[model samples]
Target: MSGPRTIWRSIATGLGALALLVCAASANTASAQAPPPDIGFDQNLGAQLPLDLKFQDENGETVELKSYFGKKPVVLMPVYYKCPMLCGLELNGLVRCLRGLNMSIGMTAEKDFEILTYSIDHREKPALATQKRRQYLAAYDCPAANDGWHFLTGDEESIKKLNEVIGFRTQYDEITGQYAHAAGLVVCTPDGMLSRYLYGVEFEPKDLRLAVVESSEGKVGGLSEHILLYCFRYDPASGKYGLAIMNFLRAGGVLTLLILGTAITMMLRKERGMMESHRLLEGSTHG
Candidate 1:
């Protein structure tokens, strides 16, 4: 029978070997998949907006996307006000970023531009919209003078239309009781055309301002619109559009390397122990 030390070593080696195999398989799988092509900017930045949906405003007044055109630039966001997790964070991030901007929503307090958040979840009622709007407005801490922000909810047809137009794809995950949706903010020209896209939770103030100014045809100004030109591009491989890979890989590569290294170390330690044990047993037999 093997000694306790030898038995323990054997168990450790087995576990390490299993871990290594699992890691190697994962790595192979990742690499085997074709590398996604780099996504660049969409050339049709000024194309007309997609589906025209109808949603109720805070006061239950029906609001249509087409109506907003020729009025003021709009910040279009798709979110379910009742979302328990990421939605709130996304909104909070936007509110924080907007509050820090030197520019106000409207130039003369007549609602120059509007921040419209449409609830993708059709079940969401007008009351929920009001509550969410109030909650976010309170957090925003903007003076009463700034009333350009709006929260809205609509029926399925309207929601689908708006989502389709903006390329906002989302699905309900029954297991998690939550919706899986991409997070981003879109800037539309006053004439209801796609202007720019800002992906992820935290948005750059300069980018946001630039998008607004560009969408306004260089009327509003803070920074150059060139920065907003390629805020987000579409990648064919990932089957989803997002920030450039160079930026994504910078954050993802470190964690990946750490996991791979740990698996390799465990595997090497396991092999060494097995070899040492075999040598010890052979020596004892020869003696």
Candidate 2:
């Protein structure tokens, strides 16, 4: 009887240890799958940005957020100038996309749109912003970048307000002394209304061009661009402009009808002219 009791006790202890291990494993897996608490973006589409926020530009001159708005759509980027990895990748990717844009989109910045990048880390100063502007402008090789592209730094209050308005959430890691932030660009309307968000380090030039045109309320693009806009709509889930199949089909059908109508009208006019000429020739011969 004693030996049987001892075996049962041992079995109970082993089962308890296994249960604990399983629970720990499940918890670890969940933790790994969950996004870091500090970093993410909330798509606050149509939210009005606080244009009164002030920041020091790359030139160390204080400027109002409204100054960059009201003329052209603004491309807002939230990044720390000293970031070691993601920020640099995002900036480089943007330059590449900008270089790839078609002539209709216009390569000049302020003329077409504005690029406003402010540091998430308030500790960073205008000096770093100036340095980064130079480095990226050299890579961009665009003369207008000096005027169109801007880098800024501000106090924590202003930075936090801007971040909240744009739904750009960030977390600072004490151990690494680095910020963890989601990479994306916010396209705002000329009136400072949030219009679109393009995510990821790499972006398609077409997407950027469409975003600019869409944000500008059709003010910055050509006829072809307007047609493209009619055919494509922005998908927030994918963060890209996807073809609206129905709209494309409808546009195609309309264009086909227009072409057919024009052809038929021209054929009828030609037949009438030929008949009139035949009558004239017959009358001349009779006379």
Predicted model with the maximum lDDT: 2
Which segments of candidate 1 are over 4 A away from where they belong? 1-44, 50-52, 103-112, 144-146, 222-287
Q: Can you write out model 1's per-residue Cα lDDT over 59-138, one digit (the tens) per residue?
A: 88987767656767888888898788878888988887777663543232114467888898989988998888888877
Give the per-residue lDDT of model 2 (tens digit) for 116-146. Answer: 9999998999999999999998988878556
Q: How close is candidate 1 to the true structure, as a TM-score?
A: 0.61
Please report the candidate that would top TM-score against the real structure.
2
**Candidate 1 local Cα displacement, residue 93, angstroms:** 0.7
Badly placed stretches (over 4 Å) of model 2 are: 1-35, 102-105, 273-287
Q: After superposition, how far is residue 80 of candidate 2 from its true place, in Å?
A: 0.8
Q: Whole-model Cα lDDT per candidate?
A: 0.72, 0.91
